[model samples]
Target: MTATTTPNSHTATGERADLLTALAKQRHFLRFTTRDLTDEQAGLRTTASALCLGGLVKHVTSVERIWADFIVDGPSAMPDFTAWTEADLARRADEFRMLPGETLAGVLAEYAEVARRTDDLVTALPDLGATQPLPKAPWFEADAEWSARRVLMHVVAETAQHAGHADIIRESLDGAKSMG
Candidate 1:
C-alpha cells in the first residue's frame, strides 16, 4: 500500500517523516565527525575504547538492516551479521577501533541504502496495525498478530537509540559538536 501525506501533518510531517528526521539527524552527526578523516583517522580510537566513527557506521547499518528487514519487511536473512562473530569479539572488547579496510564512506553508504529501503517499506505498507514477526523482538504478541503501525514506531525508536550512540562516537572523533 502507498502512504498518503495528510494536510494536518505539519508538526511532524507524518509518521514516516518524523522518523526520517531522527534518522537524518543521526546520519548527519555521523557524517560530519568523520567527514575528512583519512582511512586511518576514520577508525582511530583516541580514548581507551573501540567506538570509532567507522565502527559506528557499521553498527548503525547492522541496526537498520535488522529493523527494516525483520520488523518492516517480514522475515529475511540478515546479510551483515553472517561473518560478524569473527569480528564481534574484537569490536566488543574495545570501544573505539576500526576494522581493517573499513571506510566511513562505505559504511555510511550501506546505512543509507538500508534506510532508503526501510522508508520504502514504511511508505508502501498502509496498515501500521498490520503486524509481522520481528525476530529481534520475538515476544511481540507473535508475528501473525503484529501491526505495521507498531513496527514503524519500533523502527524509529530503535534508530533513535542508536542515534544517541552515534552522537557519542561523533564527539569522541574530534572536538566536533552537534545540535538537533
Candidate 2:
C-alpha cells in the first residue's frame, strides 16, 4: 500500500538493511499520520464506534510502551483494550481529546520523545538474532518463542499500522496535507 510519507523523512542506512528501512519508514509514517489533528479533532469520536484520533494515538502509545518493555526490557503488563467496552474506550478517547484541563501540545510534543526512545532501543539492540525466554510467561516457555528480530518486526508493524490509521483520521479532521 502506498502511504502518505513525511516531508522530513528520517535517515535510512544501508542498501538492504531491513531493520533500518522499517524504522525509517515507520517513523515517517507516524509524523505524517498525526500532522493534522487539532486538540478537538484528536479527541473527536464521530462514528458508530466513534473512533477518535486521540484514542488511536493513546492506544498506539500504550501498545508501544508494552511491547518496548517486552523487547528492550521484558514483557510489561498494561491495559488490554480488547476487554473494554464503550465506556472504557471513551476514557482512552479522552486521553487524545484535550479536555478543559488537557493539552494537545503535550501529545504532539511526544512525537520526538517517542522517536528518541525507540531510536535508542533500536541502536542499542541492533542485533535481532538472539532468542530470549520470557520468564514471567509460562506459555512462552513451550511453543511460544520469539527472536529479537521478530520483536523488532512486531514494533514496526504495530507502529506502521497505527500510522496508517492516524493518516486517515487526521485527513477526515482537516484538509491539511500530510507531508507525503
Highest TM-score: give the candidate number: 1
Find the 10 residues in a row with the least total lDDT in model 1: 1-10
Instruction: Give the clashing pairs for model 2.
Output: 70-74
Q: CA shift at 91, candidate 1, in angstroms?
A: 9.0
Q: Write the per-residue lDDT of candidate 1 for residues 60-87, one digit (tens) a residue.
A: 6676676666654565543333345757
TM per candidate: 0.67, 0.66
What lDDT would each prediction earn against the true structure?
0.60, 0.59
Off by over 4 Å in 1: 1-13, 72-97, 136-146
| Residue 16, model 1: Cα distance from true site in angstroms | 2.8
